[model samples]
Target: MSAAALLSPSAPLPYSGAITDVAGIEVGHHTDPRRPTGSTVVIARDGAVAGVDVRGAAPGTRETDLLAPGNFVQQVHAILLAGGSAWGLAAADGVVRWLEERGVGLDVRFGRLPIVPGAVLFDLPMGDARIRPDAASGYAACDAASTAAPAEGNVGAGAGALVGKLFGVPHAMKGGIGTASVKVGGVTVGALIACNPLGDVVHPDTGELLAGARTDDGTALRDTRRSLLRGDVPRPLLAGTNTTIGVIATDAVLTKVQAQRLATVAHDGLARAINPVHTMSDGDTLFTLATGRVPLGEEAPGMTVLSVMAAEVAAQAVVRAVLAARAVTTAELAIPAARDWPGRRAAA
Candidate 1:
């Protein structure tokens, strides 16, 4: 059985240009078979702004000046979130190289290093098990970005991503890259995510889940109700082998502390959309960049409001990634069907 059966989207929905609302926030991706996993970055002009928030013990995040609030908050030059897990952390090195070549960064006491903020998820270990993200792969991941697509599913760090692993991979659904954005108080909030979680997702409005859990034959949805009420395995048979990563981008002004707070609030969005999120095993992390143009500062309630919107966008992106994923019949994991699936054409 797989998560393919238990969850679904309300209906197929396109991005509708929501992710691109942020000014100068350009996204790039690089995917290679040798690497399989890839990376995504939101690039801005030199000396823009940034900040971050760290929630997991095993996190591989980098260049977090973007999330901190202050005069420095608005100067995020770029952000990188990638899939090699901890090994993938090197992907940011390439971004550093790129920005260095282009002369984009801050010139504080640190002697003007390229300011590329980032976050990473634990996917390589699960996707290939034996494989870990390497410097060569990181270089390859970066070299291919010039022609990269926001290509959804089975690509980048999401290349081998799977979700709802309660019964293990057999019962999991394919999940990959997804992106979304929204406007609040004239500020554009965009979320780009790599969905690799170990729990089922709910619609939020109705208690009925849209996706997750398939039968043994891989044709029908399993009853999560029974799985819960029956307690087939005592203590909820959970393994902390999952994570969700993203950056919340806005043109509003914020400090690194406020940006970090923004990231904290943004986690609420992940929690609202993803069930059983930020768990012991999942190294869930979110980064927030002030972009430093607008004059928005840290206010808990205001941050909370933005966090709610971010959560909504993040959840939608996760669902979309699953929808865009194509079921693979590989020996490691095989999904029989898709839920709330989208953008796939049947093989001719």
Candidate 2:
């Protein structure tokens, strides 16, 4: 079916405004009740060609090397995104075991070994640092997988997410998970992001700041970009303590190399929406998965179109993440949501 046909007046499949709109994809989340931290899983039970790109300097990842074009593993059974800094990488272990039990993964000589590559963002500072997502968390998220639109904001890996932390956590705003999808030609490109950047989130088209570091009074936003441009020095943040991680999936036929390119170009979306992204303190990473449901005639031209759509959806997802977030208050500090910002509400 052509993209036009899918968007016709009588088209059957309606856009969900979530990554689950992509065919052959299932999303699940597990938000810890004990604390504001958790894990998320994206499953491709039938397997999908996958690729990855890590742009941030202090990434905490697992099995990303295998996604290289020259590597032997060309597909991934699932992708995991979790909170808890380096410890969150362990969440992938549970996903691998779950997939193995279901007979999903690369068929090895003795048994099936599920190929689950994952990344983690730092959320340890938000709540109880010691109570991070464990293996059980990954299993629960996988168990919750479904084709339905997943919940957004303050859930899963984004539960503890805080953005615009250039001044410090106390000045940051609540961040969360968001998803978006767009159809191009005959394929659908979707993105799911756990936004926890060290910088501010801006409207991609309007160049308006939606959320970010707040003024000393915590009543107004202190635009991070302009603050830096004014020679304002920010407090030193711990490396690997902040990051934004996400996945981009599409229902288009693409080679492993093409998938990697898509992931690379998709970073443009992050740049467009995030101020001072991919910084030393931010372990930003993105992955791409191709389900091969729709085939394009020419690889070059198709990739160009797909890449553009991928960036658009990624930027949209980032903006939605903060917009959907809710205010979080604790004894130590209080973080406001974008919607609660008086300036933003007034503009709206």
Per-model C-alpha RMSD: 5.9, 5.5
Q: For residues 221-319, what per-residue lDDT tens digits would candidate 1 score against the true structure?
A: 453445756664513433335677777777676555666677777777666566667766677777766565555644323666666776677766776
lDDT of 1 at 70: 50
C-alpha lDDT (0 to 100) for residue 22 of candidate 2:
88
lDDT for 145 (candidate 1):
44
User: Model 2: runs farther than 4 Å from truth?
Assistant: 1-16, 298-301, 343-348
Across 1-348, the per-residue lDDT of candidate 2 in tens digits comes to 322222222223333378888899999999999888999999999999999999999999999999999999878989999999999988898898889889998888899889999999999877778998889999999999999988888999999999999998998999999999988666899999999999999888878788889887777888998888889899987999889999999988888999999999999999999998999998999999999877776442377788999899999888878877888887687888886556441111
- Sequence-dependent TM-score of model 2: 0.93
- TM-score of each model, in listed order: 0.79, 0.93
lDDT, each prediction: 0.61, 0.88
**What TM-score would candidate 1 get against the native?**
0.79
For candidate 2, what is the lDDT? 0.88
